[model samples]
Target: MAGKFIVIEGLEGAGKTTAINTVARVLNQHQICDLQFTREPGGTPIAEALRNIIKNGLDNEPLTNKAELLMLYAARIQLVENVIKPALKIGKWVIGDRHDLSTQAYQGGGRELDRIFIETLQTQVLGNFKPDLTLYLDISPELGLKRARSRGQLDRIEQQSLAFFERIRQRYLELAERDNTIVTIDAAKSIAEVTAQIETTLNAWLTN
Candidate 1:
């Protein structure tokens, strides 16, 4: 059987790292150990470069919304072609920190970009490529950002207004509702509770 792709997605501080660890533990418990880890706008030299520019502006030049969106797709394609696809072809399960869904939520919804343009670019760049399972850690912008701030300085995207994150969360929930592959977890719960939820959900999916 071919390897599966699992992605963890959420706002700035929705405990994605913890969720990913849980997923890995569950997969390992199932005796599925071969894994390839990746992060969007990264996982390759070219994609990493794009990720830097996307996270931090260059030479104080203002990056336009459309340009940012285009760069994201470019980096995504690079990671997909150079890393993700090859790993999956070799039967290595890929655990992704983020994927196309981030762009859909952050850029399309948070940045208020045109849905048609983003969808067209998605088609042109990724085609049918997507994660087999996506775990969305749902949390309010206020709480999420508060937690993010505790970690340290915020990145460019993280520095966005609360309203921005609200839009992103709304978009994430909207998308997750229609997609059976996406499982939303209440991130405001205790860490133990969140871990239990992830374990239960992933174990059920793995068994099915």
Candidate 2:
């Protein structure tokens, strides 16, 4: 049987790492031991390089929105082809920190890119490939930013204006509303509460 592909997505500081760990532990309890972890814009050497360039500004010229979108897709495809597909083919479940939804929310909403262009690229590059399930942690931009800033200096994408993140959040909600495969969680809750919710969701999914 083909292994499942599960993705966790959220804004920066949404505790995605912690949630991922919790999900792994819960899955382990269910005897789902063969698992592979991956993150978008990374997971492979070349993809990691692209991640660095995308997260940090270049020295001379500002990166254009189109260039940023292309870079993100390039990194994503690299990870998906080299890491995700291979792991799944070997019968190991793949859990990702982020996936295609990030592009829809960030580029389509934050950068104000055309939705048709994004959809077209997704179709051309990915075909019908998609996660079996996506857990989306929803958080207010202010709280999310506050948590992110507490970690350290903000990255290029993290330094965007509040309006930008608001748009991203809106886009995320819109996408979630349209996709039944995506389950939204209120990330503003306490860590324990969030973990409990994740556990419940994962358990239900595993059994179903």
Candidate 3:
């Protein structure tokens, strides 16, 4: 049986990682099925190295909007071929911390890169692979940055101005609206509340 694919998406510091972890734990407790949680950019060795470059920095001009999109898909292809595909071929429920939605949010939304180009690259490079469901954690960039700051120093992308993040969040909302598979969630609530909401939604979704 093909396993379910669940992806979590949001601006930096939106608590997507925690949500994905919690969802996996809940599934395990119920013995629902094989559950696995992972992140992109560094899912595979080659990709992880590229991930470091993206997250850290390049000595030259910061990655251009188009270059950023290309690097992302480069890492994505690696993630899918080496990590995600093999796991899904079996019965493992794949819970990803982020996916193509980031392309829409970060590259398309944040950088104002070419939308047609991004979509075309996705179709050509990624092929038919896509998440079964995406959980979009909706939160203001300010609150999200506050949380992120509490954790540690900001990375390259995180260090970008609030205006950039705001654009990214808006793009996320747009993608969620256009795609039925994407479920937008108000992440302003407490972690427990958000987890409860997700569980309730998933339970309903799985039954039908």
Q: Number of the top candidate by lDDT?
A: 1
Give residue 179's error in model 3 in angstroms. 1.4
Per-residue lDDT for 1-208 in model 3, tens only? 8788899999887888778877787677668657766787778888888888888877765676677678889999988888788888987889998899888788888888888988899999888889998989999999999999999998888999999999999999988999999888889899989898888767766766
Residue 185, candidate 2: C-alpha displacement in angstroms? 0.6
Q: Write the per-residue lDDT of candidate 2 for residues 90-208, one digit (tens) a residue.
A: 88999999999999999999999999999999998899999999999999999999999999999999999999999999999999999999999999999999999999999999999
Name every residue pair that clashes in candidate 3.
Answer: none
The per-residue C-alpha lDDT of model 1 at residue 174 equals 97
RMSD over all Cα atoms, model 1: 0.6
Native RMSD of candidate 2 (Å): 0.7
Q: Global lDDT for candidate 2?
A: 0.94
The CA lDDT of each predicted structure is: 0.94, 0.94, 0.85
**Considering summed lDDT, which 10 consecutive residues are worst modelled in model 3?**
28-37
Which candidate would rank higher by lDDT, 1 or 3?
1
Q: In model 1, which regions exceed 4 Å deviation? A: none
Q: Which residue pairs of candidate 2 clash?
A: none
Better of 2 and 3 by lDDT: 2
As a whole number from 0 to 100, the lDDT of residue 184 in candidate 1 is 97
Q: Each candidate's root-mean-square deviation in Å?
A: 0.6, 0.7, 1.3
Any runs in candidate 2 off by more than 4 Å, and if so which? Answer: none
CA error at residue 188 for candidate 1, angstroms:
0.8
TM-score per candidate: 0.99, 0.98, 0.95
